[model samples]
Target: MKILDKYILKTFVITFTSVFVILFFIFILQTVWLFISELAGKDLDFILVIKFLMFAMPRIIPLVLPLSVLLASIMSFGDFAENYEFAAMKSAGISLQRTMKFLTFFILILSLGAFIFANNVIPYAEFKFINFRKDIAQMKPAMAIAEGQFSDVGSYNIKVDKKSGENGNFLTGITIHKKSNNFDGSKNVIKAKNGELISNEKSNILKLVLNDGYYYEDIIPKKYEERNKIPFAKSSFKKYIIYIDLSKLNNTNNEDYTISNTNSMLNISELKYTIDSLENNRKKDIISFVDNSYQRTVTQGSLSSNKALNDSIITTKIKNPDLLSNFIPKEQSEILQIANNSIINTNYTIDSTEQELESKTKVINSHWIALYDKFVIAFACILMFFIGAPLGAIIRKGGLGLPIVFAVLIFIIYHFVNTFGKKIAQEDGLTPFLGCWMATFILTPIACLLTYRATNDIGFINMDVVLLPFQKLFKKIFPSQNQ
Candidate 1:
């Protein structure tokens, strides 16, 4: 029995390792295709491209590991089934469930290791991947002006509506935004009908010549000038020259990347902390908004000749257009003044609500999704192992041919369901727990069904059972006519 267990384990281990390498390389090709445009023709260093791929590799592991387990298990067990190895084992008094014990233990360990990698390695890789992508985008400042997309270049962000000329240099309908300084928080915008970029790599400067453009720069208001509108200067230039410094573009040589507390960059524990903080702050904002709205609508009563007052009355109640019949001339002016203030306050409330809701979704739901996602993929590894092993026995078709087809089909379904759940979760349509685990709930039952069928040695569909009743009904309906 010990010798047999070792023999079974040897094939499983070898198949698993080979499948992992094949699947990892296959998924890397997908990553390359996705960002090929970002890397191609940008004159980037080979080392930068390699670093980008290296950082991106970890993100794909979580996606591939489960699929590899499925494929390898299916292929290995399919071979065992085809060779009637299970029959020989059963003849020797070994049950199918007993045969799975060692493999099951191995799979559990792999699942835990996957969890560790997801928690520790992926977060670091994701952070580096994002920053490396940014650095690559900066390699050619001109290419950064991608049509219909905002591209950040140094301290300025540029977008061009139409791009023409060789290497996409000539631009039309251009908008440029310089980063706002922290001190005053004013925006500087440049809108141009067209522009052309000329790079001076030797001096680390980019010259953008704009034709028929207007420059708009916001002037920060003094503390006392808060009530006044923020003053801005706008002027038109037939031809303007804007100098952009590129000295800081990838200046670190890919060393020190600033790790943001953004959802994608943070691990599970960091994610939980950020989620709690955002929820607490969001609650405070809701309370503050409600208080401000109440203060605006209800105020202390002032003595009136035609007293129709409570300690506090909503401004709307007193001066509502529908309540014109109750109007008193002396209170009319005051009511009108209060009515205008109430209108402004209502709009303010609406804007505040929208802004806070967006912030909460961005800061809270995103982190929650990331947190749940870590566990989902880790658990999927174990789940896929069960699914694949049994499916292999039932199919009884070994080698890459049939196993590849089944593995890819199942993975596509899994990946699609997982992506759908995450999308709805991000939209707040479902709770984080439900949305993140949605696929697991749906797939677990299928896995169980397959396992039961394989253990009982039932055929994939039990076609004869399904067709017998239909055949009998057909015979009854037509009586076969002795044909």
Candidate 2:
């Protein structure tokens, strides 16, 4: 290796390392702020907090790594250009491409490493992070029930006005909403003047003993007309006890934890498998629904009866518009009621099926987006480097001033576009492939343009290209003295 190549590589390495550490630390703080609610007001040990942060730290790499590469590239190359080092190299017949050769190779290797990290490390971290989060609630039961807000624990959403005991076990103004098993929303409400939390470290159940409480449960009527009455059972109690299961909350070690249902917790292979199974299940569901709907709404007997009715009506000189006239009055009323009920039921079924299918489709799209994100992170490293290196060279400014500004602006645009694309893709507004690569596609051309300009020694922006038309328009309107 030449002395110059070594110098360039060393310069970039130092800058990249510094920038990466700073950005990574900043992002870690941001993550803490984002989840501060989970940490705050909860008496958690220091070791558990450290574990939470450690598990969450890796997921920030995709965001931090690219920005680091970008900022470092801009700073290092801008410093070289600013100091006229590039001029010395150019005079000695060292082109920009020749200078970038070693750095480019390094970035390619970094990109590959980024891909491996995204596919393996990030997913593992996400799995551990989520399970760790759930484990915290079980480890410290008070964490599961925050003061003054509803906290979902097992099948109940518990809220307390205040907690006062040493472990924050004694509660005041406790309210609990027991979630329905069939997603019918919370129909049972339990309110207490005060409550006490009792738990054993070795046991998986937390007992909530309430005093001066009332249990109110709504009783849904089977008849539609009776529903408007809103019949409910309300009972006052001097004391009530509720037991919550914490057994399944901290199953991080279970072998079945590998098949976590969240899109972020799965690697590329698992995501692919899950997506395929979900799509196949959706297709099967649709087919079964269609078959069931067909049998319910359109039967061979109904078809024949309808054909006979139509034939009889056609034979008359004036076709009877009132088809129900052919039936007895009693049968006519029964037919009308049955048809109305069938139509209502079918409409309800259709709406439910549509919603279920839409949900399943969104989940599938999310999996695809997750799969594509692994590759996107890898590509982003190279893309950011190309953009930053050229931009730095063209700008000819170094240090934390202009380079930071440019890097921030470019990175913000990239982040915004990526988020927008992911949101659209998750909602099925765009295909996952296009959505995941949208930012990359948008920025690649800009990178190429910047690289070309830097290579040929052109300015970052051609002022004439932008101002020439305006200059011509002014000349034509004002009839310039020279003209």
Candidate 3:
């Protein structure tokens, strides 16, 4: 590498690394706050909390990388600008555009990293993170069963009288109250002499092994005339295995799972199958609707023809009573009425089928829209870098305080607009991709403008100068303003 390239690379790496670390910690702190809020008033495993952070790192990297690049660029360039290194480079016949060539290359590399992170690493991390949360939730019973407190675990309320950690297991005096609303509102209480929680890791089963327990069930009598004293069953056991259902811990491949917009995370074959299935479903719906409409039309014509025949026969009977018996028989008239009724019933069935077909078409359209939105979100990461980098250069503030605030505010605004657009697209018949990426689309031009202004040294709005007059006027108007 040239000396200049090395200098730029070194500065970029240092700034990027420092900013990434700071942003990562911020991300962790925010995640911890969110997790704590979510798990508030519930017992959570501390180890799981750490596990969540570890799983979350990959997902956080995607978010951090773009902003890190933006911040690092601004800081590195700002440092150059502040120290007159940019002037020195210019004095050495190096143009600003040429200087930016190195940074642009750096940005390209970072963008590729972001893409890889988003496409591969982030998806895997998200999948694991989601499963980790599910595992934590499944382990709620073991976590909730604290010493000397009643904890509701699935269908049973269990209270441990004493608990002690012994040889990689928990030994406790367990009392269980199992209530079943299914059995005409009955309550069963089981008191055990002693029990130990034995977790079989291979099977993912939490076994509550009880020794010497009696089950007492209180059942409500169906009738007042009948005796209502429910007999409690007492049974002494050497050991009992109350298996905790950990079916939730079993990992299942979610073929339909889509992250961002890339279908590569999903089984591509499954996505293709899904698309094909939806297409077939749509075709079927259209065919069904057409068939039903045709059937209804045929039934309507038949019903009209029958009514006309019945009207003509009645008119003939009125015109000549002697010829009435020859014109139409009583049995034949009854048959015509029944045929008309049958046609009307057939028409009603066709109408119902048409309504169902319409509904299915709407559902198919919704899924297509959802698929489109996913694609937009996946590609928006690249757009985000373009937006962030130029904005950073325009702001010319590289410190943690200003850059962070700027990044967060931009993200928040972008997120809100994007979310709102998606909702509109989903619910209000807006274009799906357009709705999902409207924020990015709208901000691109703004970013371009910022880039242009920054490059040309065009002065944009300065909040510091804008607020300075107000600050001075406030001090003059109110002495307490200074205080």
Name the candidate that leads on lDDT: 2
Return the top candidate by TM-score. Answer: 2
> What's the TM-score of each model vs. the native?
0.74, 0.80, 0.65
Stretches off by above 4 angstroms in model 3 are 36-52, 88-93, 136-162, 167-194, 198-206, 210-241, 245-279, 282-395, 426-429, 461-483
lDDT for each residue of candidate 1 in 259-282, tens digit (9 for 90 to 100): 454677788778888888889898
Q: Could you give the candidate ranking by lDDT, starting with the highest? A: 2, 1, 3
The C-alpha RMSD of each candidate to the native structure, in angstroms, is: 8.2, 5.3, 9.0
Of 1 and 2, which scores higher on lDDT? 2
Q: Candidate 1, clashing residue pairs? A: none
Candidate 3 residue-wise lDDT, 1-483, digit = tens:
588978877877898888789889998888878776445434555766676788877766645665566566666666676577766886898765666676677666666655555545655676667666555544533554655767656567888776665332454577898857684666777788777776654565667888877777764666755536664456666777787665554332333432343232333244456667866987887788789768866655435445656565455544555543544576356655766787787788778877776565555445544455444444554555555555555555556667677767776777688778866765546765577668778877876777676566554566778899998888899987678
Clashes in model 2: which pairs?
Answer: none
lDDT of each: 0.81, 0.89, 0.63
The true-versus-predicted C-alpha distance at residue 303 of model 2, in Å, is: 7.3
Write down the worst ten-residue block by lDDT for model 2.
300-309
